[model samples]
Structures are given as structure tokens and as C-alpha cells.
Target: MKSKITVMLVDDHAVVRAGHRMLLSQYENISVVAETARGEEAYQRYIEIHPGIVVMDINLPGMGGLASIRRIHGRDPYARILAFSVHDEPLYVTRALEAGAKGYVTKSSAPEILVEAIIRLAQGDTFVDPEIAQRMVVQTVTGTDPSSLLATLSAREFDIFRLLVNGRTTREIAEELCLGYKTVANYATQIKSKLNVRTTAEMTCLAYQYGVLNG
Candidate 1:
């Protein structure tokens, strides 16, 4: 018999983790090998277990999922990650993919969709929730979506940008990201310059306009 595919679950909620475990357990071909509640721990666990697939949440306790995905994919180029996030916004999807996730699925998706995404990613295929995929395609064709401009930001820059728009101060962002104050401040300035925004208000306005932050 073929060996089952191993999966690692990374989310901050124990309840969510338990629900996922129950859902995935019904499949004979997939097994939950490990779980972690923080992004930093996710990378550590990934290195140790080397699970066949990683189901990661975007809003993690430490470093955040985008950072974790970047770290894991940076170390192991073949790492297969499925981003399971509450964020249905196109910006989050774009940044998650940019950060090296093999697939993106919203939390609101049916359980079957998540299972199908995991199987597809395990098979080296990319998957995106159909609604998000269609919206992205429409945006691309209409040339009206702000995602093209947002895509210019690197993974780290994008993370900083999101925090900045959410009213996270430089010091707070630095602390949350575990970066030096000066470095985060500099990134803030650079991000503003890249986005051609003069102030945090402008940044917030742009974020709201693009659905980066729900109004």
C-alpha cells in the first residue's frame, strides 16, 4: 500500500486545529503529522517533520504566516504549502502566493474544497478558491484592480504595508516582527515611497480602496 501523505497544521486557534484534524482524518490518504500555533514554530516543526503538505493560517501569533512561508520555502525550495486564511481579499491571496504558498483557500470555503486543495498541492498543482480565482482573472482583464501595484511590494514590504495600514506604529510592527526599530522604520519609509503615499492616512485610504482592509 502507498504511504499516506503527511500534513502539518499551523494556526493560532486550538479549536480550528482540532476541526481540521477531524476533517482530514476522514481521508485514508492524508494524515496530520504535526500542528503548531505560531508562525515561528511552524518553520521549526517543518524543518523537523518535513511534512508532505503544510496548511497554514495567515494571521499567526509570531512573525505571521507570510513570513513563515517565506522562511520555509526559502530553506526548502520544494516545500508545499496551502494557505488557509480568513482573508478573502485578493491582496492577501496575492501576497500569500508571492510568499511561496502552493495554494490558497479561504476559511469560508467548503470543507471539501480544502481537502481537494491539499490533494492538488500534494500532486504539485496550484489551487485557489474558485471565487478568488475568478475575481483575480476579472481584475486582470479589467485593468482596474490595485493588486498589480500592490504586487510590486516584496513579501516583507507587503507585510509591513499591511501593518502600517492597520494603524500599527513603527515600534509595534518592529516588536511584532522581531526587527530592530530602525530597520522597521526604514522599511516604513521605503514602503511609503514605493506606494507613493505621503502619510499613513493615504496608506489607509489606499488599503481600503483595494479591499486590503475591510471598511
Candidate 2:
């Protein structure tokens, strides 16, 4: 008999997790072994469970998914993570891959794609959503890097950048990210300098231009 592939699901929404759990349960060779709502808890749970694969969301509250992927990969270089996100922008896909995710799948993908991604990751293969793959190819061919400024920001800086562009106040971001006010201020300054935007409005504009913002 083939051993079932164990998976850890990390998402903020309870209903979403439940739905995925049910969906994955339909497969005889796959099982969800653990679940978490916060990105900060993902690495810890991974350490405790050591599941075969981790399915993570990118826009998690607190440490955020990218940071969690980095931490897990730092601890276990061989760890396999599949980044599942609603953000289909190539920037998000690129960042997730750079963070050590073995695969990237958009939430809008067909349900079967999620199963295919999980199975592929379990077998030590990479999977990317077809839509994202096409976009990445176009970007590569055009030589137009939509994530130029985003690529320059370090992981921490990128975390702060997302919050800032989403209209979070410095204090609010500091509190949510558990950074000192001065630390967040310093990161904000660095992010602005790297992006070459003097104001938050400009930053928001850049995010919109790059398709970071949904609307």
C-alpha cells in the first residue's frame, strides 16, 4: 500500500481551511496532518509535525507567509512548501519561489490544480499555476520586471512594504509585525529610498501599477 502524503495547511480563514481539508480528504494518498491560521505559527507547527509538505498562504496575519517560508527553509533546507495565494501577480510568485517554496498555486485555480500541486510537491517536483506560468514567461520575454522595486526590498522590508502600501500606519504596522516603532520607521525610510517614492501615496501608486493591489 502507498503511504499517504501528509500536509500542513496554513490559512487565516477557518472555512477555507475546512473546505480544503475536505477536498484533500477525497484523495486516498493525501492527508492534512496539521493546520494553522497565523504565518508566525507555521514554522513551529512544521517543526513539531514534520509533515511531508506544507501548504501556506502568502497574505497571512503577523509574520506573513514569505517570512515563515524563509524561517522553515532556514531550519530545514530540505523542507517542501507549496505557496497558495489569491495574488496571482508574478511578483508574488517570484517572491514565494525565492523564499524556498517548492510550488505556487493561485486560489482561483481549479480545485484539481491544488491536488496536482500537493501531489507533485510530495513527489519532490515543482508546480506553478498555468496562469502565473504564462505571465512569468511573458515578463521574461518582454524584459520588463514588474517587481523591480519589490525585488530590491529584503524580506523584512517587503513585509513592511506590503503593510504600508495597504494603508497601515507606521504604529499599526509596528504593532502587527511586533517591531519597535523606531524599527518600523527605519524600515519605512529604507523602503521609500529603495522604491524611490517620497510619500505613501506614491508607494500605493507603484503597488497599483505593479498589480500588487487587487482593485
Instruction: Tell me how far candidate 2 lies from the true structure as C-alpha RMSD in angstroms.
Output: 1.5
Tell me the tens digit of each residue's lDDT in model 2 across 1-215. 99999999999999999999999999989999999999778888988989999999988887888888998999998988999898988888888889999999988999999999999988989999988899899889998876876889987888888888888899998888888999999999999999999999999999888877631
Clashing pairs in 2: none
Least accurate 10 contiguous residues by lDDT in model 2: 206-215
C-alpha RMSD of each candidate structure in angstroms: 1.8, 1.5
Model 1, span 50-105: residue lDDT tens: 99999999877659889999999999989999998888877788888888999999
- Report residue 177 deviation for candidate 1 (angstroms): 1.9
TM-score of 2: 0.95
Q: List lDDT for all candidates, in order.
A: 0.89, 0.89
Work out the TM-score per prediction. 0.93, 0.95
State how far residue 72 of model 2 sits from its true place (Å).
Answer: 1.1
